[model samples]
Target: MSERYEYQPHRLLRQRVRDIPSGAEGVLMAVITEDVSPNGIPHWVDLAYIRNKSGREFTTAVGNIEPA
Candidate 1:
């Protein structure tokens, strides 16, 4: 089984694309359990717990860039 991630107490972060093999663009939400890089900035994001304008919850890292 895969590990489960919690969404409660929604946390926000200002992370840079460290790896995007795909050409898609979009806002990505990842588990901030550990720091990835020095450039990976952390911040509180206003998570509404709803689909984005494009009807997506944290798109793939390679997906289109979604607004925050």
Candidate 2:
């Protein structure tokens, strides 16, 4: 099972894919599911809210950051 759509302050987000820089790390705050239209079809996307090392909080699609 995966972490649900809730705040997990201790969860770490490390960049392993090209969407984010390698070795970059952050705190995963929450994972929210939203209905999105990428190409017209409604798709549920997991948006990971994170706080970077510099304390800047941002959200990105889940795959760009992995749990560490």
Candidate 3:
């Protein structure tokens, strides 16, 4: 079973991306739950909007972020 995602504002995180440096740190601004399943069970996927030190922001899958 998939783990339930929690809203963790102000949490320090590291964005896991190919182009961005692994050491770059960011903050978890918000956790958004999007309902992707409309039929039976609700398929809620968690997404995170992060702001890096440079003030740049981007959204990615929750799995793309990790504790920093």
Candidate 4:
């Protein structure tokens, strides 16, 4: 089952980087902008408007995010 997340605008979140090889664990911090779930399951989020600690922003799947 997919986990449910309650996200609010501007809320800081920690996202895991699973796409990277080498099994190098990495976490990215970002602020929530809006829910981008296409099936209305809150499974995706838009972070393009928020930047990370390095001032980088992106949109990713909700499975990558966790409470910061």
**What TM-scores do the predictions have?**
0.24, 0.48, 0.48, 0.27
Candidate 1's C-alpha runs over 4 A off are 1-3, 6-12, 15-19, 32-53, 58-68
Q: Residue-wise lDDT of candidate 3 within 1-68, one digit each (tens)? A: 36344555434434333213344557767767766676858788777777777889777776666666
Q: For candidate 1, write residues 1-68 as lDDT tens digits.
A: 13222343323333333223443333335432322234645433323223334755543322323334
Tens-digit lDDT track of model 2 for 1-68: 23323333324534322226454557776667766655855566678777776887777777777655
Which candidate has the highest lDDT of all?
3
- Report the Cα lDDT for candidate 2: 0.59
Tens digits of lDDT, candidate 4, 1-68: 24443345433335544322232333554444464567876654444222345655555543444433
Pull out the clashing pairs in model 3: none
lDDT of 1 at 13: 32
lDDT of each: 0.35, 0.59, 0.61, 0.44
Per-residue lDDT value at 21 in model 2:
43
The alpha-carbon deviation from the true structure for residue 3 of candidate 1, after best TM-score superposition, in angstroms, is 7.2
- What is the lDDT for 4 in model 2? 26
Candidate 2, pairs of clashing residues: none
Residue 9 shift from truth in candidate 2, angstroms: 12
| Better candidate by TM-score, 2 or 4 | 2
**Best of the two (2, 3) by lDDT:** 3
